[model samples]
Target chain A: MVSKDELKKLAGLARVELPDSEIDSFRKDIESVLDYVRQIQEVAVGDISEQPQGVYGLMKNRMRTDENPHPGGEFSEEILNQAPQKEGRHFRVKKIL
Target chain B: MSINLEKLTITSAHRHLSNGDFSVEELVGACFKNIEDKNPKLNAFLEVFGDWKEEVKKAQKLFNEGGATELTGIPLAIKDNILIKGKIASAGSKILENYRAVYDATAIAKLKKHQSIFIGRSNMDEFAMGSSTENSAYGPSKNPIDPERVPGGSSGGSAVAVSMGGALASLGSETGGSVRQPAAFCGLLGLKPTYGRISRYGLIALGSSLDQIGPFAKSVADLEIVFNAIKGEDSFDATTLSEPGGLVLPKKLVVGIPRDLLSNPGINQEVIENFEKSVEKLTDLGFEIRDISLPNAAHSLAVYYIIMPAEVSSNLARFDGVRYGFHKTGDDLIDEYVKTRSSGFGREPRRRIILGTYVLSTGYYDAFYNKANLMRNLIIADFEKVFESGVHLVATPTTPTEAFKLGEKANDPLAMYMSDLLTAPANVAGIPAISIPSGFSKNNLPLGLQFIAPAFREDVLFSASRKFLDE
Candidate 1:
């Protein structure tokens, strides 16, 4: 079983608050998935490769020229309007310090 | 409504529109009538678009101007995950409850060019997390066939929209089996194209490496038309591939069945029987059938679980109450982030994020995440080998059985996750797969058979699916 303390720490790292009531049930639910997925450890995969690619084969990620096609701030008005809290042209956030 | 929306496929609708047998507005109104009549109990749409009239007007003008395409004025339900500019895309999670899109997804952009009407955004599992729509924040979407049962998800509402005749088709996104599993349960045709085949620019990311937007319809041919409109190169999503030149298929194509994987006792006997009948039916279609080995496939589910969540943890980090979306305040900035996200996300997404953090944590990184990635490569290689031996596509039951009763697996996360077991491998391999309606279970519910084609080979899937269903 994943210890409650351990799950608490994981929730913190994941940026989620784990209410005390859910600790036990959540741990069990998470562990069940983990236990099921642990079967991959039994499979034999010999030598590990330095680089990995998924089924779709391609080279390095593509990059475009440093250019903005739709003049700057085209979508800025609509985007800024959605901010839950906002200041002049910026998203307002809670104090860092 | 005079028209039976369920009986009209895209081709027949196109013919009718061109022949002036019925106007696009009449067809669209019939669809809205179905939505009005059926959506009350089905809960297929989260919000039916108010702009459909404006869209319908443009489509009618296209027909009058003789500029209509096959998809012109066709009504489609958009899954909440795919963005349509200036519209709210909640993704069935509380975190994005009021968030609206600022730009259009590449797929939506492609469809818009054809003047396809957006019916509205449909419901889905939170962050596309769960296999059943029970995880949807709004509420579970009922199966059209049986209200007591689930419409397998996280594309449940999109599936229900087509199954209930609310929309002629729908656009759904998938990370692992979200499109195909639900299509199977709802008896609709669902296609998940190869990763990079459809651009993911405006999609709400679940797993960046595994996600793709797919189409759902009643007929394979309709699905193909919708697919062709949206697929191809896009500068917005760097992962997207350029359109390939013509693919010349062999006169004879071979299909491989991974019987060893299918024979698991966990699979429903009725589903197994139906799968066998589908196999036999394929033999009658003049295609060569062979039993093939995919030794590493058994590990694919585990690999998918690991890699998917690890990516999920990374991808979902953006919703920290800083910019747009649902937010809450706390003692400090970090606390604010935690509190906002904790309350913003539902149970399933929160659980996945935490599970993801554990696997990618410092001490466990090498053991879990790295091992899964290595195993994923082996799984992908296994498909490569089978295809190298001249297998055109791989076949399997889309799910273990038909849709189960609502709340049957809701409490047990493991059981809910297991519903996606057979379909997840294709996502792990980044391959294209389609679920075609195969017959029904004794419950009179729909069942499906899936065919997986190699990466970037959606052509094979479309052809095979059409041939199978047509026969």
Candidate 2:
């Protein structure tokens, strides 16, 4: 089982607040999922290149001229309206420090 | 109940509208009437658009002007995840409850050009996280076919919209089984095209790699029309592929059935029987069928769970409180992110984010995420090998069983994940797959038979699905 401390740390990294009540259950859930996925370890990877699958075949490099101008935003006003706290065109955030 | 809109398919509706048998207004009225009567019981639509008439007016002008596409004036329910500019796209989560879209999804933009009317934003599993719509912050969408049961999700409400005739078809997004599972349970045709087959811009990302916008309709013909309209490359989504040239299926196509995978003990006997019957029907239709083994298929679900959440965490990181979406104030910016997200996301998404963070976190990255990526290769290789050996399509049951009761698997995350087992492999392999309505189970609930083709082979899926429907 993943320790409760580990779950808390994970929740912090994920930017989610894990209530004390959910720590045990989350640990159990994470552990079981890890257990299920552990089957991947059974297959010997050998000297095979670790470049991952499904990425290369689906994507290809399609370069565009750098000189081309980016599409100017027509949605700034609408987007700003959705922000919970905004001043003028900029979204307002709490102090970083 | 005055009109049986449920019996009307888009093909027949188009013919009627074109022949001047009924006006677009009448068609739209009939759909709204169905929504008024059925949506109360079904909970399919989160909010039915009041501006449907105005949109249809434009479509009617197109018809008056002449040379209208087949989808002109077709009413479609948009899944909450797919954006329609200036509309609420909550993605069934509290985080996005009041968040309106600033731009249209590529699919929505394309459909608008065809004069398709947006009926409403349909409900879904929060952030497309759960297999059942029970995870929606709003509430579960009831199955139109069986009100007591769930409409399999995260495309549950979109499926219900079509099933109840609330819309002729719906645009639903899928990361794994969201579109197909719901279509199977609701007895509609659902198609998940190849990964890059459709642009993902304006879609609320679940797993960037696995997600694709798909269509759910009453017939394969309607599915094809909708797909043609919404598919192709977009400047916004770099991952999208340019239109693959059209394909023609061979006269005698050989379909492979991964016998070992289908024979898993978890699959209900009724589902197995229905799947076998579907295979037999295909054989009788003059298609060749063979028992094939996907040796690495067993690890697909595990790999999917790993990769999906990892990508999901990364993709969803954009939803911080500052830019847009739900916000909560705290002493510091870090606390604000934590509180806002914790409050905004529902149980399932929160769980996934944490799980995702764990897998991609330092010290564990190589073990979980890397291993899973490597396994994805083996799984893809298995499909490539099968397709190389004369397999035109791979067939399976869309799900292990028909729709279960709402809340049946809610508490058990593992059980909920199992609901997507058969459907996830196609997304993993980045292939096009469709779920076509098969015979019903003993419980009288609908079932679906799934067919997967090689990447960009949507034509093969369409042909096979159409042929199966004909049979």
Taking the tens digit of each residue's C-alpha lDDT, what string does model 1 give over B288-350?
999998988877778888988899999999998888999898988899999999899998898
Off by over 4 Å in 2: A46-49, A52-55, A67-74, B1-3
Which 10-residue window in model 2 chain B sums to the lowest lDDT? B1-10
Candidate 1 residue-wise lDDT at A60: 52
Error of 2 at B298 (Å): 1.7
Give the C-alpha interface root-mean-square deviation per candidate: 1.5, 1.8
Clashing residue pairs, backbone N/CA/C < 3 A, model 2? none
For candidate 2, write residues B98-185 as lDDT tens digits. 9889888889999888888888999999999888899999999999878999999999999999999899999898898899999999
lDDT of each: 0.89, 0.88
